[model samples]
Target: MKKKSNKQVLEMLRNMAEGLGQTFAPFCEVVVHDLSNPKNAIYAIENSLSGREVGQSVTELGLARIQDPEFPAVIANYANTFPDGRKVKSTSIGVKDDSGEYVAALCLNVDLTLFQSFQAAISQFTKIDEKEVHEHIEAGGNHSDRIHARIDDFAAARATTSRSLKPADRKQLVQELKKAGLLEVRRGAEIAAAHMGVSRATVYSDAK
Candidate 1:
């Protein structure tokens, strides 16, 4: 077994940064900093969300790691913000040479703007009146709505749309509907079939 040189280690880290950037693309920025050259430390950058470029100076964290051999090798999930004011979650990992001197740093910055917007949307979408109202509703309409809701729920549980369910999943959904006695309701088969984008005969076959 041979120890890898600092350059070799940094190259490997650069490759890893590229792969990680691609894997979490559109939201994550990966950077590799060569600490030995603090003036132009950024050796590589992928998914450049922060508008920073290669050859940029080392970050404060990277400088800290270079200044202190005893610094933590990994500083993870720290709150950060991009130059454009996007909130970020960041992780920085220090790479040291065999002599235990910091040689490079690999960092990841994940943008949270899209996720924050999605969270806000979900909060508003799920907000409802706390007070309950007792009102007369049509039984036929209620039954039909319930049937369609069940189908939608089933598909959601499987991480798919009702019409995009695989054959086996569709069969299982039909069987569950039959067991729940939903299939016995008037026009239930027709409703389920229509919602699932299948024929009534196909729904009946799946029920069996």
Candidate 2:
């Protein structure tokens, strides 16, 4: 097997960076830095969220890795900020040559501004009034409603409508309802039959 040259390795990393950029597009910036040429280190860039160009100088982190062989090869999920003050989550990877010399760096900077906004929106949307406003919406305690709910839930679990449930599924639903004591409720079989579009006799047969 042949070892890849630094240029070849960098090219492959460039391609990988492009793919990553596309996968996380509109939210991430992917960059490739050629550590061998610190003066013009930016070899390729995708999804330019940071507005950086391909011919830009190496970042401080890149330069540090280039100078220090013992520097960590991967630094992940560090907090960063864009020039425009947008919050960012970043990861940097140092690529080393066969001689164990750092030759390039692959970096990903994910913009968190939109996600932060989404978080804020969700927080506000789910906020409830502190004032006491008693409301009884769920009929979970009602025997009739519970029976109907169980049948509907069983049908949904099988990805079918209650009326479209197969014989085996209907029998399973009846067993589950019996276990829950819902089948013992007065007129429970009638209610289940109505909801499931089946005859009460059929419900009783399945329950047995």
Candidate 3:
């Protein structure tokens, strides 16, 4: 049985990426590469509203995010744009191969020609529904202790000494305190007191 060369494998990978873009696009391009020697790695820039340009490297474009440690894969919200005044969006999802090797990264850049109209029409409804859902969650829960703990966290993250009863501040505090299980879905006043290093009486008093 014959086996494939390095060139053959790269080509196969490229074809797969480009085909995926055409099949599922706002999806303008598919970028693939190994960072070890990224200069030599190939990409399949396919199904482009710009044109079907293929076979390039990140080096060729003067773009160098192949080495960023923190953001190995990111979804660029509004990073891509189109000719004749349409818009595009791109996101890259990185994954290791079956052998646990951090192989190639796949970036899917999609054009938003028809997608934008649907987005515009439904955006108002989406926002309204989300606000209503959040309101419902706020009304149903007996989470006063949990909420105050998070308020403390928000203040700490921002290095704020001043405390106010603002919803935004409360939300931020909740996110920061949430790590200590303060804003947890289930509230236990006794357990919360233990975590806060405070008296249970204080917790009950604050519940009012």
Candidate 4:
């Protein structure tokens, strides 16, 4: 098979860079570096988030790869920072020809500023503030009112009319009322039985 020329390789990488840039736009930059020309390695750039342009010199990493034949084929998700202090994550891939010499590279730089902001929001949302107030209900007269309120609360939580509750639901209600100490109140069983349209015996059976 005939080996591809430098121009052909550059054309292929240019198409790849353009596609990657369009897919991840605004937050990602795609650069195609012609490693054979270290003095002006950036042959193409798209979605240029870092303000770099064509004809730019190879980066320090690129130079390292040029000096070392054993350089990794793919270096991924390494941390980077832009000039303005925005965090970025990057990946670089070395492209070789039929001769197995690194001739070009494709690099992707992803801005992490938005992701960091989301992290900060999640952290703040989950944090417990010690100064926040805890509510309490005043202990006073009107035990019957409290009992009635408890029954109403239970009915509302079940999303059904108290009087229309089935025998099984009435049993569950009785269990809840007993747990709340409402069943121990005077006339509690009679009031609950009437409210739930069930016999007092049924409430007592459920509480047992």
Candidate 4 lDDT by residue in tens digits, 1-208: 2235877998999999999999999889999999989999999999888888899899988998888868998999999987788899999999887777888999999999998899999999999878878643423236556766777777788887778776787777789899988888777887777767778998899899
TM-score of 2: 0.74
Poorly placed runs, candidate 2 (over 4 Å): 1-4, 141-174, 183-208
**How do all models score by TM-score?**
0.73, 0.74, 0.38, 0.60
Using TM-score, rank the candidates from best to worst. 2, 1, 4, 3
**Model 2 Cα displacement at 12 (Å)?**
0.3
User: Which segments of model 4 are wrong by more than 4 Å?
Assistant: 1-4, 130-208
CA deviation > 4 Å runs, candidate 1:
1-4, 125-176
TM-score of 4: 0.60
Q: Which residue pairs collide, candidate 2?
A: none
Writing each residue's lDDT as its tens digit, candidate 2 over 1-208 gives: 1234878978999999989989999899999999998999999999999988989899899989988989999999999999999999999999998788899999999999999999999999999989877754643347777787788888888899989999998998888888888877777777788889999899889989
Q: Rate the local accuracy (lDDT) of all candidates.
A: 0.92, 0.88, 0.52, 0.85
User: Least lDDT summed over 10 consecutive residues: which range in candidate 3?
Assistant: 1-10
- Overlapping backbone residue pairs in candidate 2 total 0
Better of 1 and 4 by TM-score: 1
Which candidate model has the greater TM-score, 1 or 3? Answer: 1
Task: Assess the local accuracy of residue 147 in candidate 4 as a C-alpha lDDT between 0 and 100.
Answer: 62
Q: Quote the lDDT for 2 in model 2.
A: 20
Residue 5 displacement in candidate 1 (angstroms): 1.6
